[model samples]
Target: MKQGIHPENYRLVVFKDMSNGDAFLCRSTVNSKETIKWEDGNEYPLIKLEISNTSHPFFTGKNVLVDTAGRIDKFKRKYAKK
Candidate 1:
């Protein structure tokens, strides 16, 4: 609702979910050095994401654990009752 406070450089950008390899095109002002050819055969700026609506547990209604570098195991070992 403010004037001159919004970005005027909105451009089509492809957001790719690394977890599910899902990608979608949307307008964004974020900068990226990578580009991807979309389904429409048009090149767009590519933005790699670790998780998105497609692969997110909250959005997909699936309780999944994504453990990296043995974090879950380390937590269990540290907090486990002796």
Candidate 2:
């Protein structure tokens, strides 16, 4: 490990899973303008996430669709010519 390579501004931040509205507090150096009052009566930086371990298909053992880039339609169109 090299010195000065890690950020010293690691503070408790609230990460919310936007898909499921689940929020958890953890140390993070990431910056966010949004703030939310946590359960501990403290306001923390809110980071909205599309998926988390709780809502992910791999962790929850369920099929989930995440189409941020329309890859499925592109693939189908490309293969439909055959």
Candidate 3:
């Protein structure tokens, strides 16, 4: 591990899986404007995640399509001209 390269602002942050609405607390330095009241009665930075292990197809053994941002549309438009 490299010294002085690691962030010192590591703190407990709540990550909510948007697909399953699952929330979990973990150490992170990510910034979030949202705050959530945890079961411990404390507020923590809320980070919304589109997918996590709880809802991921690889982990849950289910096929799912997560189209974030209009990536598919952009891909088609860019290649359609060719």
Candidate 4:
């Protein structure tokens, strides 16, 4: 391995804020925000996420609808023409 030629690897926490609940886990991601404290007396940047495995409908054995790119309506419109 070479020195000064590789990106820095640091420890950070990932927080998921889902409709059902919230969770925290250790991960390596890029962030430029200030530090934040956790209940375990550890401090890291506060990263807020919308979904994770805990609350994802597929993982939780429930049905869900995710329409982020308007694909649902696009498919409907295209299929309805035939």
Candidate 5:
């Protein structure tokens, strides 16, 4: 263990906003422009996520098309050989 040579480790919150819902949980990640109000009415570093366990189809047991933009089709058309 070294002092003054390692990055700061602090408690932070990760917020997930997805098609299923939104949730907040504690994590340790870096963020430059995210903030969240804690239970004690204090602001802390926050990370915004698009997909998480709650919204993931595999975890929810729901068959869903996660991609709304035709990205899969575009990829196939571009890479798949005729």
Candidate 6:
């Protein structure tokens, strides 16, 4: 265990999975301008996540494809042959 090496701004933050609307509260130093009322009736910093263990394919044991900003479509269009 090391002292003064860890972040001093660790606070309870809400991590939400946007794909499935799943959220959990945990300590984090990540900054967020958004806030969410948690189940415990407390307001915490909101951190929106594209993929988390709740909705990730590997963690959930379900194969799923996540497309961000239409990257998959862009790639397909770029490689599609006439």
Which candidate should be chosen as best, given TM-score against the real structure? 6
Q: Determine which window of 10 residues in candidate 4 has minimal summed lDDT.
A: 14-23
What's every prediction's RMSD, in angstroms? 2.2, 2.7, 3.1, 4.2, 4.0, 1.4
lDDT digits (tens) for residues 12-75 of candidate 1: 9999988788999999999999999999999999999988998888999989965535789998
Error of 1 at 9 (Å): 0.1
Could you tell me how far off, in angstroms, the CA of residue 60 lies in candidate 4 after the best superposition? 0.7
Local accuracy of candidate 4 as per-residue lDDT tens digits, 57-78: 8887978865546789999999
lDDT of 2 by residue, 1-82 (tens): 9899988999999999887889999999999999999999999999999889989989999898766467899999999999
> For candidate 3, what is the lDDT?
0.92
Supply every candidate's count of residue pairs whose N, Cα or C atoms clash at under 3 angstroms: 0, 0, 0, 0, 0, 0
Angstrom error of the Cα, residue 69, model 1: value is 6.1
Q: Estimate each model's TM-score.
A: 0.82, 0.77, 0.76, 0.56, 0.58, 0.88
Q: Could you tell which candidate, 1 or 5, scores higher by TM-score?
A: 1
Residue ranges of candidate 5 with Cα displaced over 4 Å: 1-8, 38-40, 68-82
- Alpha-carbon runs more than 4 Å astray in model 1: 68-70, 73-82
Residue 68 of candidate 2: its Cα lDDT?
Answer: 48
TM-score of 6: 0.88
Error in Å for residue 17 of model 1:
0.4
Rank candidates by TM-score, best first: 6, 1, 2, 3, 5, 4
